[model samples]
Target: MSQGDERGYGGNEPAGHTDDAYSTLGGTRQTRTRLPRGGDEGDGYGRRPARNSRSLIMVVGVVVLLIAAIAFANQGGGGDTSGNGAEKATDAAGAGPTAATGTKPVQGRNGTIASGFAHDEQGAQSAAANYAVALGSAEMFDKTQRDGILDAVIAPASVEKFRTTLDKAYSIGFFRNVGLNDDGTAPAGFTFVSRTTPIGTKTTRASADQTTVEVWCSGLIGLAGEGSTKPVTDGWFTITMELQWVDGDWKALTHSQKDGPAPVGGDNRASSADEIAGAVNGFGGFTYAR
Candidate 1:
């Protein structure tokens, strides 16, 4: 039951009936279809050791069940590695206990996510796979890229209380029920489509400071164009993070989610809306590590 949070927001944008609010703490599971039973990401361990009184941990971060892919020009999301790319990222579906162990990434950044890692346990599983792609991206629905990604992956003594409970869970009724606006963007000629990739990672507790790491994601939210009505979709979940190593790398004190190891959705014929907004604007996302 604890493969733990990964990719699904989707685990992001909430509105009317969004579930998968990161597993427990008033969780209902649905893993994302709309979102919002409550989010900020779940599981911080033992519930609370006064982690800023845990107000929705990262709030709306369980990415607000897709924050509708918090459009940084709709880029692709990806991270995680073990060996043989984790058996082709679980497709061959056999020899994967966390694939792809070429281990390259991690030069260092922070402003745009990925930062210096390697302090062990594969650098806290590459800082929990790029902090679960900036906690299920689409920049957590704005507010200045969600306060610069909670000051680059939270945990500076719980960054201003997770920016005041994710600025009230990205309010304005979560940007008009996940359609976005009121500064969350995506209105004219819409294109927004959130993304989170990962697919492998596992630690369940490491050293050097702290670690939990459990990625296994696969997210992509809605809104392409053509009279948009929340079109885009792709989900699978698991995201339990609890990293530490602060002031140098690996942040996030918590972040939980769940739903699937997911695999079984074929028919392969659903790309439209301007070819899914031209493959999410000619794809270009990758900073996450392993």
Candidate 2:
């Protein structure tokens, strides 16, 4: 009889029943009567039930519990929602464990910016991708461009601080150290390009309005020239940013980066200095979005 194997109640004893009494889950109780004990065989209550039957009951109960949990979560019980009526249902459907899984990139409200990030791991990844684009742009190298970006993307209170530090960072001396000419310019017949292209992004941790995002990126930097000591070169690095939902968009509270998780370059011949210079001068960068 084994007390009718109360494991059917998720190994939990029913309320009001002692620890050894019975089993129940949620607000429901298992209704099966105790199996007969192994004695007084002439009476119907004196024989043990089959072990196979007990196993079947436990399996069925567990399956039902699993289905109910999934249903509750799907009905918006255990997850967050945007509360905006216009796109709440659409966003909720795009959510679940893989909110960012769709084929097309999510678009922001006014067009071209990033949106559709949800309240989960996928949302954090989307935010990271967009942030990477913002942080790695050529705009970060120019004072006017940098200020506009900071004002538009950073939290207002932190904007001034970011601008002050970044102004100092993009100074002429800093540019020279990274192989640029003294005036943050390239040498004759050369073009200087410092750019970070993202490979992928992810969240190491997340919560409602805060998250830590890590982006793996490959960058092109250094000065390009013929008979030059420093030629345009490529490197891979990972940038990690601590982000917070500010105003209506995600913004970085702090950002730090480190060098490769890089792989070796291929054996293909390197482009000539003139070729590299022409390509860089002819091409314009994109206003990247995730």
Candidate 3:
């Protein structure tokens, strides 16, 4: 079959069902899970993608995560190589193939997410992963922080454009409408959390200085608070990013997302508000690869 055929999402399928939509379109065996025969579950790849296969991707990504770690893990913990007290950080995994040899490593880490970047596919993937985190973060619900993120990661040309639109998306009325304070603050005794965890990333297209990356991200978006009507909820979205090897790192040129490409969620018991809050504070996010 043509790769496109393998990835096509035509029937009742939603948008961005990479495996179904993409496989039908490109005939690549990209999808890891089987879709429901027809109806919205197999809507193809136009609007909302399928959500019943994400766990499969997570399983696959765990392998990549291990490989990436081995490629960079040091032998004896880590020794100081920077002449200063700090140990020189290792290069990002999966970067040598695209980067000029010996290019310095890129920095990464944001408030619970990863940021900064090196100059190759690994770096690009890292950037894409983190950008997905930032884009899906609760910060996006705040105007000032959202603008700062746009300015920091967005391609220079597209920043102004997306910003104008996002301004309306995160407006005061929008926040109030969502049960947030007019200033985008959470009410007392409540912890607002919005996070996207990347399952995997691939380079659909690439150039020495540019790359088109696709990230399969499973995200949780909802309000967390006692007495809240809308509790924490989850969704799956795929983010496609166009990145340029800029000044010293990869910067997003354009990014768009579509929903679905999801799988049916397992029947795990929902945790209480306090339990969720404790988990959020105890665990941290990771710098993704694959």
Candidate 4:
């Protein structure tokens, strides 16, 4: 009533009048408004001050500073790289992140399996990887090669134990179930494939005398031929081995396996049996695997 009825706008001012403006965000704001310019016809409502242009500049400057800070942080200020001028890592305790050591591979072999591994964390991981391959290979179905593999890869203290256990495990029934003959040979016109490919190796526990490691692997098993009941299929798994420094090399004292970090299957078409068999026969596997 004081401003609208008869005093403020009705008596002393025009029909339309402007009021003082106030605005705030988190208790910070401008409480001023602009007067009409010299001869401009403006609505009753006033505009913010022309100097408010500084707010836009301030916001843009802040954005630019934020972007620069992010770039610096990403350029190895994040402490994830080992480039020049970066601090070197100390992993003498055998509990460090995995990286390429560029150590020469073991030049010795016990049968087809690698041997003469160094008595260090790297050696432990290498032994675990190769042992997983040997233990999962198609040769393990044949008792003779199986026994030799156990002898080469198992710790001296556990060699006989593993041999006896595997003898019972790989029975004639096991061979037949895997589409192999009684002598572990592929049936006529078919190729039996049981291959394990180690993807990465990790030393879970390590010491001078013994170490435990896990190897992540991708494997293929079954038969490769036309009209085969057991077509080759792929799987992923992890193999854990407890290795001992036996005599002069790393050997498995105990071994166990568990299923995957498997990836989702791709939409690629399955190849024909002839193609699969051809690939298996044409490609020779690595003998001195790491």
Tens digit per residue, CA lDDT, model 4, 173-234: 44544456666687778888878898888776555576778888888776777666566666
lDDT of 1 by residue, 1-290 (tens): 11111111223334333343343212434234322222333222112121131222233333433333221111221122231212222223332366557876577686778788876678778778877877677877788887888788866766665676567656665565456665677777777777888877777645556666778889887667765545566667777766677666777666656667777555465667789999988988886664
User: How does model 2 score by TM-score?
Assistant: 0.57
Model 2 segments more than 4 A misplaced: 1-100, 109-120, 179-183, 281-290
Tens-digit per-residue lDDT, 47-94, candidate 2: 232223333233222222222222222221112223222211113233
- Top TM-score hit: 4
Candidates, ranked, lDDT: 1, 4, 3, 2
Residue 51 shift from truth in candidate 3, angstroms: 19
Cα lDDT tens digits for candidate 3, 1-290 = 12221111123221111333223212223222233333354334333322234422332222122112221221122112232233222333642343233544356554444556766667777788878777767777677788788767766656665676455445454454344566777766666767788877767766667777878888764446555533455667677777776566666766655555788556466788678767766887765543
Instruction: Please tell me which model should have the higher TM-score, number 2 or number 3.
Output: 3
Q: What is candidate 2's CA lDDT for residue 242? A: 60
Clashes of each: 43, 0, 43, 0
The list of candidate 1 runs beyond 4 A from truth reads: 1-134, 139-141, 148-152, 155-184, 188-191, 195-201, 208-214, 227-242, 245-265, 268-290
- TM-score of candidate 4 versus the correct structure, residues matched by position: 0.65
TM-score of 3: 0.61
Question: Model 3 lDDT vs. the true structure?
Answer: 0.54
lDDT against the true structure, per candidate, is: 0.59, 0.49, 0.54, 0.58
Lowest summed lDDT over 10 consecutive residues: which window, candidate 3?
66-75
Stretches > 4 Å off in candidate 4: 1-99, 287-290
